[model samples]
Target: MNREERIRSLLDRIRSASLDAHGFVTELELQDFRKNLLVQRGVGMSLLMASECVVQLEAFSPDFVAEHPEIPWAMIRGMRNRMAHGYFDIDLNYVFQTAKHEVPDLVRIVETLLHIHPQGE
Candidate 1:
């Protein structure tokens, strides 16, 4: 696939993962998220997947990534790095907050990006 195609694929992956993460905690409380290992893992893995896609998206072209200043690319990359390097050390609070709030916003941003930047010019 070409660069644009790769970006489109990555955006789709990010959107899917974000949606899954958000859905996992649709009506969940922070205490419940902390208490349930399965839910915690599901959110963590979904965030990780989205972060990994962001990393790949950056790799495809930093310039292309730069064009989209709305996305928190650096923060996403940091999360990916943290998850990849020190999964056990991550704080559940941040994960819960991101899944509950940020992921939904991210899904909307990704959908806009997909619509604006189609597979081909």
Candidate 2:
């Protein structure tokens, strides 16, 4: 697969993971998540998936931010960094809120990107 194709795949994976997490939240499958952490395991995994998607996008298209100046590259990268390096100190509430709110926006953005840049073999 080409770079854009790879990026699209990563975005799809991120979205799928987010949906799974949302399902878990909807199904109340996060007793451990709520008791052990402020958030649930599914939400944490969603954040990680989202972070990985952003990282893959950055890797595939370093100039993506320049191309789409509306996208917040710095903030996304910072979030990815925090998720990667500050694992132990992660705020579960923040993760839960982000998954509930920010992830849909990210999905929209990724979908737009995919539409604008069709993945070719």
Candidate 3:
């Protein structure tokens, strides 16, 4: 897909992942995510998917990220890179924090960007 279409698709995926994360509470999610092997894998994968979408958003150009100073673009991409490369040493706490908080904020920020710049300007 073209850049605009690609961005839109990434945004949708980000939104989906963020919504799925709502089922987990911070403390409870963190506990379950750490103790349960299946939960850990599932939650880790979702976090990875969401983080990947954030990284994909950066593909639009540094200008796109620059325009949205309110969003944590670098941190988002950093999280993805860290998780992608350090899969074995992944931090469960970070994953739960991301799912419980960051994903929703990231989705809202991207949705606002999409609304204000429908064609990605």
Which one is best on lDDT? 1
lDDT of 2 by residue, 1-121 (tens): 7656676787677667767656555544334446754346557766677667767777777775467766666676777688788878877666666666676677677677667766552
TM-score against native, each model = 0.94, 0.72, 0.77
Q: Per-residue alpha-carbon lDDT of model 3 for 55-84, expressed as tens digits?
A: 777775666667678877777778878878
Please give the CA lDDT of all the candidate structures. Answer: 0.91, 0.67, 0.73
Total residue pair clashes for candidate 3:
0
Evaluate model 2: give its TM-score. 0.72
Candidate 2: residue pairs that collide: 33-40
lDDT of 1 by residue, 32-87 (tens): 99999999999999999999989988987899899989999999999989978897
Instruction: Report the C-alpha displacement of residue 98, candidate 3, in angstroms.
Output: 1.5
How many steric clashes does model 1 contain?
Answer: 0
- Considering only N, C-alpha and C atoms within 3 Å, which residue pairs clash in candidate 1? none
Looking at model 2, report the run of 10 residues with the lowest lDDT sum. 24-33
Off by over 4 Å in 1: 118-121
